[model samples]
Structures are given as structure tokens and as C-alpha cells.
Target: MYVKFRKSSRVFLITVLFGMLMILSASAQTGAPINVRGSITDVAGEPLIGVNILLQGTSTGTVTDYDGNFELRVPADGVLEVSYIGYKPQTIPVNNRTSVLIVMQEDTEMLEELVVIGYGTVRKDDATGS
Candidate 1:
């Protein structure tokens, strides 16, 4: 008058239950994606175009438009790394902020190479004097 489950059936049931619990717990731990918007500018307060905007620790990234404005979807808590040529990179923390404005500073170091010859200054490649 009673039904009994075989060993394989019991093991399968336990495995299914465990998997469900794991999925539920994982869903509870991570948050939903949020819309994050931001803009990038230079010290002169001019919009910086084509800036690389990347989500920290992830391959997800975007680039600033012609107006240096970008909208990215990220977790409520996330970090953004903004970079451009000739400018110092900036790391910004989301912290649940929906909007952000950043000003990029110029890198003061110069990488130009020059050689002083007996006559005048020449490019590093053109210099053949010892």
C-alpha cells in the first residue's frame, strides 16, 4: 500500500534540489543591472570624443560619443575606468550613482625624442653623430 523510491531516484532528487537551492542563492546574492550615465571632459571643459570607457574587471566597455556622453548598464555597485590618449586614466566608482561627470587631466610627461648635433637639433632617427 506504499511506494518506495529506488537509490538512483533518490540521488537524482537530491541533486535536483541542491541545484535549485544554488540557483536561488546565487540570484539573491547578485543585483539587477542598472542604467548608468556619464560624461567625460578635459581640463579645458571640452568634451572628449572617443574615450574608452570600460567596466572594471569585465570585458564590457563602451566609447564616448562625439559629445563625450555615454550611457552604460552596470550593476548598482560597479567601477568604471575611463581612458584616452594624452590624458591620465580615471577610475570611477559607481556606488549606486546613476549619473557621473568626469574631467580627465593631461599627462605631463613628454615622450618626444631629439638629438643635439654639432649644427642643430635633429630627430633621434636622423642623428648619426657620435
Candidate 2:
């Protein structure tokens, strides 16, 4: 009985195993969902109510609690978009983080073009050209 166990063959087997491990590790890192918790507040330091928290570039999202706290599952590299009425939308990257604190800023650019000609108010889209 004879067995052939060359050193070169052993090294090749080790290298293959190492390569497979690296590939699997990298694959597990990509698009992995992680649990993230955060709080949303206004610039005035008040907890924002019913804030819309969504993962950027995706439809997955949730709403903040009445206390402005929220928890969601997001990709390790995903970005979050937080939005609320009368507030500017904010985007934040996960970057493998587990917790976040967000302060929402108010938006003042909304223009309700109301034209008053003594009694009726005409919106920009309702005006007619004669």
C-alpha cells in the first residue's frame, strides 16, 4: 500500500479553502439586512410624530412612533430617507451602524399661489387665459 501526499498538493488545498472562505464572507456582507433603531426629532428638540422613515431607493419603510422613535431592518449599506409634513426630507447611510438620531428641518419653499380678485381665490393651475 502506498499513499502520495505531496507538499504542493497540501498547499493548493489550503489555498482553495482560504479562497472559498473569503468569497463566502464577501457574499454574506453584500445586501445583508441589519436591525437599526433611531429617533427623529424636530430642530426645536421635540419628538416628531408620524415621521415617515424609508430606506432610500427602496419601498421598504415604516412610520415613527408618537415619541419619534423607530426601528427598521435595513441593508448594511443602505440609506434612510426620513420625511414629514412641512419638514425637509433627510437621507442617512447605514454604514453598518445600529443606532441613529435625526433632527428634521422645516421646509419653507412651499408656495400656495392663491390669487384673490376681490372674492374668489384662484390657484396657479386654475387660472385661465382669455
Candidate 3:
């Protein structure tokens, strides 16, 4: 009976080891998260400050610095969504690259209209020269 119990315990240990190996291999195949850095610019090659850079389908995001540069951690195969006021939004794929540069086009339709609000008032004493 003692010999039989030892054999069964060994088999159980081997099964546990096999399961752990399988889990590790699966995680490796799916790939790990990576850090991505990049810059945003307009069509004229001017840096776009405060541009939005978001991980597609997720709330994870960052904004460009004063020089239009940004950095964020994302999945190995992830997409970036970029947007700014008066500019057409863009979708970019990281493709496992650590760095990238994006150029945005202007959205003339959105910038075509403008609105201004003000209130004008005149003092009666000043107007009448009292």
C-alpha cells in the first residue's frame, strides 16, 4: 500500500508541472504588453500640442507634451486613436514598434463656423456729459 501511494503522488506531481508549463507557454504566445512612444504633428510638420492619444477600444490614453511627444504602455498588437480640435481624427496601429510619428490633417468643416458673445452697455452720466 505504501508503494502504491508513492506512485500515485508522483503522477499527481507530474500532472501539476505539466499544467504550469502549458499556462506559461500560452501566455508567451499571446505576447506581453509593450511601451510605445511617438510624436504628433500637423501636415505642415508643426508639432501638435495637447493632442489626444488613446488606446483603441480602451480608456487608457495620454496627451502630447509641449513638443507634441507622447508615451504610453499598450498591448503588443494595439491600435492608437488620435484626435484634436479642428483636426481630423486618426487611427494608427503600433505593429510591435516602439516608436512612431503621426501627421494629422485639418478638418475644415469643423473650423468653418465661429461664434462670439458679448454685452454692450453705456453709462447715462457719461453719455449726457453730466
Candidate 4:
């Protein structure tokens, strides 16, 4: 005599197979890399184009576009630094982040003139009649 699986057993087996397929598909999609996008701007809220946005301690980097927008592929664990000439650099920590907005402040310095003489260097004030 051969033992037979009942109708409920057949239905349960089919359901399990379908569940496994769904799990595999979901895992595949989640394993794919994520694209990160963001914008960089100055304290004045103006977009800064041509700014260098790089992952800290890594060669992976991208430059801001004309609209101060940038896109990059960052790993699951990645941190980035956004920098531009004459602007204070900013470092951002990114982990599974999809988008970011950065605001950079300008470095302040006292504008002073310096004169280079044949013998030595001198400040503009020293050269002028005090």
C-alpha cells in the first residue's frame, strides 16, 4: 500500500515554495547597491558648483554639477567630506543614507597687505609713513 499526501499537505507545500521564491527575489533586490544624491551649498544658501565631494580616506569622489547637485555610490559604511576653495570643509557621516544637503561656511580672515623687500619682508603699514 502506498501512502498518499492529503489535499492540505499539497497546498502547504505549494505555499512554502511560493514563499521561498518571494524571499529570494526580495533579497536580490536588497543586495543591490544604493545611489546617493545630494546638494552642496554655502552659508548664503547658494549652490556651489565644482565642489569636491569625496569619501573620507577613500579615492571615491564626485564633483558638484552646475546646480550644485552631486551623485555618488557610497558603500554601506561610508563617510564623506565636502570641500571647496575658500570655503570651510565639512565632513558628513553617511550610512545607508539616500540623500544629503550640506551647508558650508566661509573662512574668515583679516585682510592685511604684505610687502616683500630685497632684504626682508615687511607689512604694508611699516612701509607707509607711520
- TM-score per candidate: 0.67, 0.66, 0.74, 0.58
Quick one: best lDDT, which candidate? 3
Question: Tens-digit lDDT track for model 2 on 27-111?
Answer: 8877788999999999899999899998988799999998999999998999999888667888899999999999988875533
The candidate scoring highest on TM-score is: 3
lDDT of 4 by residue, 54-90 (tens): 9888898999999999998876567888887667778
Question: Candidate 2: deviation at residue 107, Å?
Answer: 0.3
lDDT string, candidate 3, 1-130, tens digits:
9999999999999999999999999988755789999999999999999999999999999999999999999888889999997799999998899999999999986655432224433433333332
Model 1 agreement with the true structure over 85-105: per-residue lDDT tens digits: 667888998888999999999
Supply candidate 4's per-residue lDDT for 115.
58
Candidate 1 lDDT score relative to the true structure: 0.85
Off by over 4 Å in 4: 1-33, 110-130
Give model 3's TM-score versus the native structure. 0.74
Better of 1 and 3 by TM-score: 3
